[model samples]
Target: MSCRIRIRLTSSVVICLALIYIVLFNGLALYSLTKSTYTPASVPVNRGRLYFAYLGFNTWKCKIPHFAKQPLPLTALASFPGSGNTWVRHILQQATGINTGSVYKDYILKVVGFPGEGVDNSSVLVIKTHDWGINERKRYQRAILILRNPKEALLAEFNRKNGGHIGHAKTEHFKQSWKPYVNESARQWFEMAEDWLNFTGDLHILIYERLKADPVNEIKSLLNFLQIRISQKELMCVLENMKGRFKRPSKNLTNYDPYSHEMRSTLLQYEQQINRTIDKRYRYTTRSHT
Candidate 1:
């Protein structure tokens, strides 16, 4: 072959190889990204059984089950402010490997703001909102309502507004006394709880205290309720994440005398009213298995 022809042929071969490499690499990367973003409807049941079997030579075998894929709806992790909504979201992201969206538009908050008007997509949108009233419930297919003790939640809000990390140093609201803020926070807390209690849809109520006490069981319940199946390895990873990285500082306002007698009275009254109302509708379940 002529020298010029040989050189041109070699260059063409190299270009073809480079194109092939790019295409293969990009295809693999896209597949991995999508797999990591969401849990598959079914995984190897034998894998889970092997994992457990190795840990203990127990004869229990994991049963393989098939799940029919269904269209995911817009789910909301709704709660009153300071009710551990963010913490639950963290656990969910770790457990299910899905990116949960938020409705708020705050840039600092790192949230995917609500979709544009009439823009419905084909993905599950998990939003976090403190909005009260049953009118908003019509927009969501399912909701996980996280409730906290009114006294503790109000106190946490009081500290958050006064001096905690979320406090604005120069804002007048941040400079105000804790009593008025606690009263207002308590009022809003009860209102939000009442609204969720009245919601006539697929709703699950999770108590913040119960979550703190038995996170594994509570998280399992949550996963079952959401219809997301995860293996034991994933559950262990989630528990580790909860223990190591997701732990937040406990804000105890009682130690600092953040509430006065009147404030305490107001919180107690609202708590009684809320408990009396919701106790009839929702009972906290400690079911460990689905």
Candidate 2:
């Protein structure tokens, strides 16, 4: 009887110890899941784990803010589609701790993270707009124009319209709609640049390639342009969480050229005209400042 009782006590102790270990392990895991920080370089490349880690990690790192308490000057974030406008908005939101607004109601964007979609009021930091025509330009007293290379912007827009953000256009899209779309898109691209360059309001031009090359300094310039003050800690947080959810993944380069000879010629003509207009505007601005 003594031996049997001793065995039972030993079993009970073992079971209790097992429960304690299990509890401690799970507690640690939950802590890591909720509180862990991630930088672009720090995230591991394991696809399955990376997806979940990003969902949990980046979303919690930056606190999305409510609408501004006081009325603000309605500023415009004007860009042609696929010119990294959404990415810029994400960066601004991360840094300023205020929601950015858009004129168009993008339900997908609203569901993902942007709470200020379709709101064009004074509560938003800047109202996003693709329209650079005079009528649309008149709505804002200040604007930031984001310009991207025509080739890249057009292709990116095509992919976005045909597929969801971060997805590629299907083969059918390239074969059927690519040529005509390129012609129409190129015209709009040139017009967008020309119209925004002539914007009478306080306007700042941001080149997409330059922003990619030096994100920190570029973003600093952007903040200065918007006259938004941010602490160093907040700026660092923006750097850490720079890439918001909408950025498309890099595509594999192939030897095939998507643009035909005729398409290339047409695009080049518009691109040159846009460049000339921008140069003239830059020179005029420089002379005016002097």
| Residue range with the least summed lDDT across 10 consecutive positions in model 2 | 38-47
> For model 1, what is the alpha-carbon lDDT of residue 279?
63
Clashing pairs in 1: none
Tens digits of lDDT, candidate 1, 163-246: 432332223444365545665677888888888878777888888888888888888989988988889887887776663222
The residue ranges of model 2 lying beyond 4 angstroms of the native Cα positions read 1-60, 253-255, 284-290
The digit string of per-residue lDDT tens for model 2 on 34-103 reads: 3422112212222233333223324425667579999888899999998998898888888887889998
Query: What TM-score does structure 1 among the candidates reach?
Result: 0.64
Best TM-score among the predictions, by candidate number: 2
Q: TM per model?
A: 0.64, 0.77
Cα-based RMSD of the predictions, in order? 13.6, 9.3
